[model samples]
Target: MALMITDECINCDVCEPECPNGAISQGDEIYQIDPGKCTECVGHFDEPQCQQVCPVDCIPHDPGHQETREQLMEKFIRLTASK
Candidate 1:
């Protein structure tokens, strides 16, 4: 599953650079994770870098956008593929 940023985020700008996929971005107030680009760091890292660096633990599994490991991997490949 992809991860999402909750409202509890302090917007401290800690999680932005940690994302290997560049999925995390600063929103109007809180930071947001783009589900289409998020792959939980499947191809780039051993684990989700954003979640690991988050101070408030605001990043959580997105149940609404649930996907299997295979699907996530495919998504990762497609995202990284150059146009």
Candidate 2:
């Protein structure tokens, strides 16, 4: 599953740079995680980097966007294919 930022997010700008997939971004109010680009750090790290770095622990598993490891890897590949 991908991780999502909840409204509890303090917008402290702590999670953005920690995302290996570049999935986290600054939103109008809170930081947002792009599900399409999020891979849960499957190919880059042992765990979701954003979640690990989140100061408020606002990042949570996105049950609405469940995916297998293979699927996550595929998404990661596609996201980085252009570069």
Candidate 3:
């Protein structure tokens, strides 16, 4: 599943650069995760980098963008291929 930045985010600016897929970005009020780009760091790491680095523990799985590991891997492959 894709992760989402909740309102609890502190905007400390730590998680953005840590995302290998570049799925995170500054939103109007807080950091936001692009569901289309997020793959839970499946191809880059065993854990979600954003969730690991967020000091406030604000990033959480997005129920709206639920995906399995296989789907995430496929998305990762597609993303890398376009690059």
How close is every model to the real structure, measured as TM-score?
Answer: 0.94, 0.93, 0.98
Per-residue lDDT of model 3, residues 1-83, tens digit only: 89999999999999999999999999999999999999999999999988888898999899999999999999999999988
Q: Which scores higher on TM-score, 1 or 2?
A: 1
lDDT per residue for candidate 2 within 1-83, as digits (tens), equals 88889999998988898888888999889999999989999989889888888888899989989999999999989988898
Off by over 4 Å in 1: none
The residue pairs that clash in candidate 1, if any, are none
RMSD of each: 1.1, 0.9, 0.5
Instruction: Locate the minimum summed-lDDT window of 10 residues in model 1.
Output: 74-83
Clashes of each: 0, 0, 0
Better of 1 and 3 by TM-score: 3
Per-model C-alpha lDDT, please? 0.91, 0.90, 0.95
Q: How far is candidate 2 from the true structure (C-alpha RMSD, Å)?
A: 0.9
Evaluated with TM-score, which candidate comes out highest? 3
Model 2: number of backbone collisions:
0
Relative to the unseen true structure, what is the C-alpha lDDT of residue 71 in candidate 3, on a scale of 0 to 100? 98
Could you give me the TM-score of model 3 versus the true structure?
Answer: 0.98
Q: Per the 3 Å backbone cut-off, how many clashing residue pairs does candidate 3 have?
A: 0
